[model samples]
Target: MATLRLYHAPISTCSQKVRLGLAEKELEFESVTLDLLAGDQHAPAYRKLNPDGVVPTLVDGDTVLTESTLINEFLDEAYPEPKLSPDGARERHAMRLWTHLVDAQLHPACRVVTSAIAMRPAQQRLDREQVLSDFAKVPDPALREMRISVFEHGVESPYFERALRSYVDVLETLESALSSNQSDYLVGSRLSLADLALVPYVLRLDHLGYSHLWQNERRPHLTAWYERLHLRSAYDAAIRAWEVAPAVEGMHAAGSAVHSRVDEILGRA
Candidate 1:
């Protein structure tokens, strides 16, 4: 068996999910931390591993994988003990639905929200031309435009309101699922890829000082589910242990400053 090596950034939501998956499986791997803000992902050598210049790239010897969702599924398939995928085809399908939702909707929304809120302050401090240059380097035209818009406009960015609404819809969906389901975890009786996949996105909201989205009786079931997941040992090992305190603090401060704006956009104000 070849050793696994993971290239990731401490605060990236995708990286956190992969770490959570690895932790749940009790898998050990070599960690290569990337400094995303410093444009480390764009370096020529790192780009060879992932042309997308994204973090959370997993290398299992000759097999190299990109995309956090696929990497986690690979981990479960390769290490079947304490399986992350639920039993039964129906349950597995349900789990895949959640992961798909994350990949298709939540992930893009998360990037916009994080950039418009948590990352805006930092980006504001940098040289404007340099920021534009970095945004231009993003491979996807739409994504590059999103970065530039959020950097320039913060909560006022056209993307921000839609991103906030996407989160609201997701939280509502989570609340309904957790409230109706007999099991504590999503999809099945045990924690599955579904729960692991969504945890980091929820945690991102918490880290950004946006826990109000689910907390305070707003979405009690979602709040309870989130609390339960937070207590898991894997969360501490994979997320809390690797957290960069300063960056988190900055996010908190930046996010806190925009509470009114967020509330206004969400119609809570």
Candidate 2:
């Protein structure tokens, strides 16, 4: 077995993605828990590994890698058994793009609602003005330009709300995509990283009690995709011992499940 070290936190979507890949690879690692609740990620030594202060950093022998998608691709390509990626070039490209939409784009929509908008007390609902203000804080010039482009298209726009609605729409697109292919899996035949990528977000929906938001009445096919993943041992293992991302944005807490076989592999650390 390779010497693998994973730095992770339970409630993180990105961390969960990497965990799913590791489970699929059937590999073990030494896991060090980082308490994002304590802002431990910004502490000096840990930041050396990931300047971005993200969870689920992978250290494999001499190679230290971050970014869940890249790390998962690394695991899949390197191990190449019981694969989690699409095989052909075009198929892989589509998988990568849509996976981003599910994993990356839908992420903010889920977060904005959980973090700021709805999850708060009735007295503490996010201020509409502040929501727009939060939208305005993206200082990147390129990002500013991209937001401007959407407004120029004659669509109602701003950075955050526009971004949120786009992601919600992407779910509808996913529903249509699933509708055409009766198979529960995303690519040609079986589970791929695409399915894995989307599954975390599906569980996110369930955890958030947005389960009704996607299902037979709203988008039946997408609901089926969610159900297919719900049963997998691979995904089930990754999710065990994890917290549901907090209902209230900015508030973090300990969750119910403490550990699993994944924890056992790392626990022997």
Clashes of each: 0, 1
How well does model 2 score by local distance difference test?
A: 0.64
TM-score of 1: 0.98
TM-score of each: 0.98, 0.73
Model 2 weakest lDDT span, ten residues long: 253-262
lDDT score, residue 166, model 1? 96
- Per-model CA lDDT versus the true structure: 0.91, 0.64
Candidate 1 all-Cα RMSD: 0.9
Cα-based lDDT at residue 81, candidate 2: 92
- Residue-level lDDT of model 2, residues 1-269, one tens digit each, is 56999999776777888888888778878888786534566666877898666677999998899888889989998889988876788888888886678656776555443332222332134454543343344445554354333323211224434554555576777888899985677776778888777777666545544455576478888887887776777666777656544432223221112113212322331
Alpha-carbon RMSD, each predicted model: 0.9, 11.0
